[model samples]
Target: MLDTAALKEFLQQQLPANLELLKSMVEINSFTTNKDGVSRLGKMTAEAFAPFGFNADFVPSLHPDYGDHLVMTRKGTGTKVIGLISHLDTVFPPEEEIKNNFQWRVAGDKIYGPGTEDIKGGTTMIHLVLTALQKFAPDVFEEITWVILLNSSEEVMSHDFGKLCIERLGADALAALVFEAGARTGNAFSLVTARKGRAVYRISVEGRAAHAGSHHERGANAIVQLSETIQKVAALTDYSKQLTFNVATVTGGTVINRVPHFATAEGELRTFEREIYNCGIEKLLALSGKGSVCSAEDGHPSEVKIEVTQESPPWPRNNGTDRLFSIFSEVSSELGLRVVREERGGISDGNFICHVMPVLDGLGPNGDNGHCSEQSADGSKEQEYIDVTSIIPKAALNTLAILRLAQSA
Candidate 1:
């Protein structure tokens, strides 16, 4: 039997110290591309769990520009494992952080910072939960080994990190919990049960360059043709099927006078269902071919090429995920917290690990305005913030949830 009242009291007592740690973490900028900064934050995070008997190891990324992924493991008497996942990186670069003047700030119950809502707070929440379990529920803490994965390139969607997660904890893990920011509506908080998959594509066009004024008709305009194709591509978005296409970046033409020889556009496709995802991919790939630009009375010398740069599969809700949520919700009700299951559109590490083991996400603090940084006088343009009050209760909930999961297994 567990003492819920005493556990809640312990979490409430540690609120101030946990908030201070979160502030310290927010002060350090851990942009995905900043290897040094990300590594520094990883070092600090690893030290926090060291006192609880976790041994930390840094795995180098596939590319040298990104920070090494941090994996911390605490051994237990049993071989069954429970994995907790979070990221150390934020979307904001050093320049954006400086320009937007986005640092940690406290006002009433909200703490605004760069990575506060997206994930840094989630990592801090992990520390708080494990600390509570170690002190209050010692038997539960020792029942299963804990595997903590804090990848450094989650903001940019690193495929290697997904593989690393499976290689480490996929074999015998009981359940994987992702600590992305949670959502609170009225009295109930939301836990993510499913997430949409995403694919990135780049389209390149080749044409002939010619003088604008002297030989306009003799030239092949790649930019114009690409723009026309982009319209067709953007029209692929179908709200009915929950499929969306975004033409993110476009680049074409060297000068204003000449008909440019090259053009390119980058876009993304996202969907909840696998059938829709595959269908969208097929249509996007089929668009690669010749363009409607001609070369001086000859045949059209323009060509288009489409490439899928990266992809992450969707994690649809299933029996396994529902069972995990049922277990978690029972614990929440016992602790006086109401939780609801949600299907989020954003991608996370759960999308990769769900197939390896049953996964549950949104186990972190509640907040809004995840990637926004600008601020306005009317309080419309809001920066990212974490609900200061939700931290302790969520930590207590997660602590009890983990305990019940281990004991039930």
Candidate 2:
């Protein structure tokens, strides 16, 4: 049996040092576009984890504008490998942080700063859990290989980072745990078991341009055709399958007096099931070049083209995910930490690797108001923050659960 009380006490004693580390990270602006800032934060993280026998490998991003992805590994005596996932970037820009004056501020129990709850807290949680495990559960720590993946472009949705994770962790990894900020509601804690996938697409329509008054009957109106097609795409949304589409942007004519020759629309689709997402995609694609527009008998017909700009495949909850959740639940119950599983509509790094292995996310500390820099002195407005008091219990919970998982595997 593990000494849960002792682990908690040790975590409590180390909270100050952990906060200091978190403060240092929060002070550095690591916006997704800020490659230099992201790399600096990754270096700091590597130095922090070096004490645990982990070495860092900096993999360059496919995008030259982004920072390199960090893959840190610690070899153990056993064959089973466990993957830990988090992002090094936040949504807040340097100008935004400075404009809002949202530096590290500690209230009664809340710690407010950029990236405090979204993900940097999650990275700090990794260090805290490992510190406790190294001190109290050294045997378990030495029995399994630990691979940590820190993304530099998660906010922008990773295309190369996902492949890099699979290459480093391999498909045979025991499980992947994502630290994306857990939730504490009253007495129960929540961890995410599923996340919805997302895809963005642009539709372009081309036709013959003409003057509205003089040549209206001789032209094919592309904007009118696109408007009719947009309704078809929007109608594909099904609430039962948890699938939906949104036509986010539209641009076409230079003036109201002309029949536009070209028009374009952009939108996104989201769902938790791959089959449903694929079906929706197929239906959307089938609509290309199938709609009607006002055109003369001899006029050129309008042509429609659809292209996918970006996509992150869905991560649905399955048996493997449930089994992993059960392990964490058992360990939490043993340690008097009651936990529940949650299905989130948001996507994470878990979506990329869940198919390769079982994935359990939301393992970070409790916090609220993510991606916002607003705050009010009268407690009216909210800002990004982590509950300072929730850190020790969450660390203890993660430490024991990881030990149990490694032992059972």
Candidate 3:
């Protein structure tokens, strides 16, 4: 019974203002470690969310340097609760933003900035959609409980604190929506019902060092041992199971003349199936033998250590998740929008919340070019961007989706 026309009209009317707000947000470098900047953005967001009947409260994280977590709630009359999850942090450091001359640029349909696509746009749209609903569709808005968790350090999922916020806020909720940006292409929205879990680890190898000319053969060659280990680890990835292993970083050999005494590799594991995911984790941990056969020349064992640095469980699909997607997809068809049900290889805070309750993700702007802080292979400064045209419609879609879910519940 919600008025779709009025919702779309309200969004269209406020598009320019919302874009301006996005520009302001993207300009502030809220890198995970930039605690002060994240807090400032959080405060500004709380102020912006106030007019929509949301009571904003700041929850301190386990550490002060990671910035404070934000939870905003709007009371309603219904029994069911719907949660909106988003993050304020970007991958770009403050220095990188300035070095790359990161600024919101309007070019045809694209809005170019550092955090525009990664999720700053998503955060902006969340506030805009709710504000529009309160003005044009109060009945639907006031019918169900609303819990908005604006977290910091999602790029890092830092210390499980972001997950902690979701656990705290959505413990009583029926469903949740994550405002992460959509696909790597096109403007049609994608509803993510499932995501791959990830585990990051640092592997180190220690070996005997010796001079290259005097006693090169005496050294165990840590770099060589690490190379073999990286290959074995990479081979563990199975495409059919949607499991992938990547060695993201490697460090070894300080100088050309000497066999290095220490070498290390940092890598990640991503998979969708929990059992398969756990098996891989166990295997990875087992690779950390105190002494492993690292070299075949002399059959000498080397000390290899693998320590998990971070982890996030996969967001598996369930009956409730399927039902939520059906509701959202129906609303999308009604709005003349094409929405594809997607299972993502990348994990988000949704993965954490899905453990407790079903969740819908990727309800943000659509564009590619995210997760960039490095130059392209061609050496041009790679920029992150999002489709400006996608914003209003996505905001509209999210607004209608929430209202319909709330009203029906």
Candidate 4:
């Protein structure tokens, strides 16, 4: 049994301290592409955790072009290990208008700022929890080893850095807790039991160009062929199996008066099941045909080409194994909160970890409008958000308690 009350009080005192750190981090604009900014934030995080006896290091990812990731650990007396994962990157491009606009204002108990709620808030919560454990529950900390993983490129599908983090840390991890922004107020913390797989693709069509009025029968229309291909791709979606295909963009027409010689469409497919994904891909690739001819160009014929890229694998729920879920639910209930378990259609770093261990995500402070201009500008709806500065310490204490239990077992 963990001392929930003592942990709560310790967190209440440390919230202010964590808030100050979060404010500084928010001001630093650590967008995934901003290498300097990301490195600075990583160093700052490492420095903050040093006093708590954590062996913290800023690990530059193996990806040559991505920003730095932070890996921090506190070794316990026992060998059973637990890992906490979060991303330092927010979903904002460098050229965006709101870049570096890190103004935080409190309106009726809610804090608003770039990266405040989406993830910086969650990171702050992790910090407070770990710090509190070091101060108030040294015995518990000494009994179990814990690792904190903060990646730099989670916003852009986490690319190479995410894979490196998982491959390195997933081998021995008992379970992973992903501190993505969580839900507000209700005991409803999503366990992230499952996630959909993603596949991005670029499709191009080639055809002969000709003047619409002069050589109407001499050119093949790439646009027409591409449109037919798009429909075929969309038709592959199987709603019953949660498979979906979307053609997000199309480009390549020189002028309206001329028959299109080339066109390209970019999109993605998402599915919860591997078979569904494979089936959809096969169908998408099999689509063929030069639909119609705007002109009769004897020398050139229309052609369609597609390139497929796998974004992330599916994270399936272990319906049979519920040790982590059960412990987390019980702990949240004891803390006077409702624990909600749900599946998300989207993907996260959890997908990578799920390949190796049972991962529970959506544990950070809750917010909406992720990856949008409004969310990026104001940090989601402040009023409806939970202050991790208060909630996370309790969650962390509960996690420590769970670690203690695992060690004893």
The top-ranked prediction according to lDDT is 2
Give the distance in Å from residue 324's predicted Cα in candidate 2 to where it truly belongs. 0.8
TM-score, each model? 0.95, 0.97, 0.90, 0.88
lDDT of 4: 0.71
Candidate 3 lDDT, 28-50, residue by residue in tens = 88998999999998988888788
Residues 1-409, candidate 1, lDDT per residue (tens digit)? 6788888788888888888888889999898998999999999999888998999999999988999999999988987899999999999888898888899999899999998999999999999999898898787788778999998999888889888998888666888899999998765789999999999999999988889989887788899879988998999999999999999999999999998989999989999888899999999998889887767656657888888999999888887789889988998888778999899999999888777788999999999999988888898898999998888778878888888788888
lDDT of 4 by residue, 282-372 (tens): 7887765544544454645688888796568777777422567777776666777666667788888887667667677776766654554
Global lDDT scores for all candidate models = 0.89, 0.90, 0.81, 0.71
C-alpha lDDT of residue 166 in model 3: 60
Give candidate 4's error at residue 202 in angstroms.
Answer: 1.0
> CA shift at 113, candidate 1, in angstroms?
2.0
lDDT of 2 by residue, 330-388 (tens): 88888777899899988898898888888999999999999999877997877899998
Better of 2 and 4 by TM-score: 2
Which residue runs does candidate 1 get wrong by more than 4 Å? none
